[model samples]
Target: MSDFFNNKRVWITGASSGIGEALAHAFASQGAHLVLSARNEDALGKVAVKCKELGAGMVSVLRLDLSDHDSIPGIVRNMIASVGKVDILINNGGISQRSLALNTSLDVDKKLMEVNYFGTLAVTKAVLPGMITHQLGHIVTVTSLTGKFGTPYRSAYAASKHALHGFFDSLRAELGDTRIKITLVCPGFIRTNVSINALTGSGDKLGTMDEATDKGMSPERLAYKILAAIERGDEEVYIGGKEVLGVYLKRFFPGYFSRLIRKARVR
Candidate 1:
């Protein structure tokens, strides 16, 4: 339990399950005050209870649907009223995609962008004013390694994640002197239900976890590393096993990386 997170007010979206849920528990154990949000109120409540049991100073459950753009302002307001001021905003909410570029319809791509990119932006913007006023805050976004390298069957998902990198990189530069930090977490894979809930070309759920993800790093371990990165105020951190090697390959061996990605069983 680092003193850096003790009593810190942190808000995490997508806290119902997977990485978000893991993060909620990790931060709680570190003595952070948490505001957890997700579309599933029941699941959120379950997470909140666990947070409480983990010794979170305070835990509030806020039901949120990232796809519903119109509800963002109210959600932000409610969170602010309950938590006072958020010292850390973890934008962990978003959907994944499991469709080929040609098979993915415009509607499907739009939905992916709306949730993964725009939804993250919406929440960050809502919290920025307070952070600016205080002259301090940390924005940690949970992006995928696919953001850095495009994969065969996840074009739309990759695009949305790529947009996040662009947006946050620029934002970090813009806020350079404000003492605010933006950390982009590029996770290769974690054992989660992300694949199962990922949207297909026709808006259908994939409903099956990918094998790589099933054998990937544990979400709990990933959460710990993410918190360490936040504590260090790192610009970005990639968490995973051998999958993280792809980042290096893409940077130093573009041709080989490209061919490897093309043959990857991303689905």
Candidate 2:
């Protein structure tokens, strides 16, 4: 792993905490140069220090808010100015939702799309030109299991993730002749602040963790699987416990899976 990633310039969004932070540690241990971005600059700074201590060749902190799509080009410019060209870009910044389809406000759905789908798309576009010019780069998106199939309480969230899968899958086909590769990582659930930070029907934070999220896999373990998938150039990968089986269930047993999901306890 160290030999594969040593001195590679990697950029990760949502690096302030959770899976993103764990990925920072994982990549740092492999001696990768890292650019960590998130809305919280102070938190990013703390994570940057930890990455340095973990043996990162170089670590830089950049403030990035996925909702602020207008500022993305400038951020990418600054990143290129500082780090030259990124070898890999981990599109990990996004918001989750725990709201019902009918109860959720239209504004909340728009906000979800703005941050989860368009925001990631914006960042990927900004970083793509350089990668195209260099003829080498890996684009990784941290999608969700919901991306594969819609689930309860995540209508908007699942839609946004599903859009990413469409966009990236098409982008990969378009760039098939290029050296650049795209990998979409679908994580079922992880013990993180995601549930607590999930948006509600009123567009406010849920402010509480769900039982499923609280008992999910650790961020560190998921990060390892993600990096391994990137190394292997996998087009798509799923990481989770038994919940990941839902993907296959939906695929091979759509009727049963649909009925099961109807009765499943998502929250």
Candidate 3:
């Protein structure tokens, strides 16, 4: 069991599947108390059961739709009341887009922003006060590699991720005096249903996985890295194959990186 997460009250969003589900197993193995949240109540229940089997001391399931930003605070408050204080908040629930900006509808963009940006912010705000009062907390987000740089066929998705980086980075700076730690986990690509469920130009599901995603890193591996980053109190970390190098390339050679991305087939 990991000493850092042992008995910690950790709340994980998107716990229904993919990276979230993998993370649930990883944290449970360390004997953490878990609050698993996702839009699908049934799926969350399944994950909770698995968590218990994996050695979690406590496990609770909460249904949360990130698209319903307005109701997030109420949901979070009720959760906190039942689960006690939240030691860590994993803002991992979000959708992905697969269309170009020119072909995408405004509604699609709005929905993406609402779920990936506003919804995350609302949950963090609702949980922040308690963490602040207790003077101990950690906020971890599963941002994508696109958060650091632009890529083809993911304009809205990239925008939402970039916004997360801006908000969390600023929040970290503002909370410098506090014990609250913010870790932004940037994953290049992970084998999941993100591509299959990605929004299209007309706000429809893409309904198919891409080649890159099919060959991406396993969710379980990414989960292990994320847990380590959290334990180390890393402000930010990248997890993936060669795709992760894009972050450094974009930083050191923006002009070259921009040109290279233009010719790259992201999807």
Q: Which candidate is the best by lDDT?
A: 2
**Models, CA RMSD each:** 0.9, 0.8, 0.8
Q: Candidate 3 has which clashing residue pairs, if any?
A: none
lDDT of candidate 1 over 161-229, digit per residue (tens)? 999999999999999889999999999889999999999999999999999889989999999999999
Over 4 Å off in model 3, which ranges? none
Which lDDT tens digits does candidate 3 get at residues 1-267?
Answer: 258899999999999999999999999999999999998999899999999999998999988888887888899889988888999999999999989899999999999999999989988999999999999999999999999988989999999999999999999999999999999999988999999989999999999998999999999999999999999999999999999999999999999999999998869
Quantify all predictions' global Cα lDDT against the true fold.
0.92, 0.94, 0.94
In model 2, the worst 10-residue window by lDDT is 1-10
**Native-to-model Cα distance after best TM-score fit, residue 101 in candidate 2, in Å:** 0.8
Task: Give the per-residue lDDT of model 2 (tens digit) for 185-247.
Answer: 999889999988899999999999889999999999999989899999999999999999999
Minimum summed lDDT over a 10-residue window in model 3 is located at 1-10
- List the candidate numbers ranked by lDDT, top first: 2, 3, 1
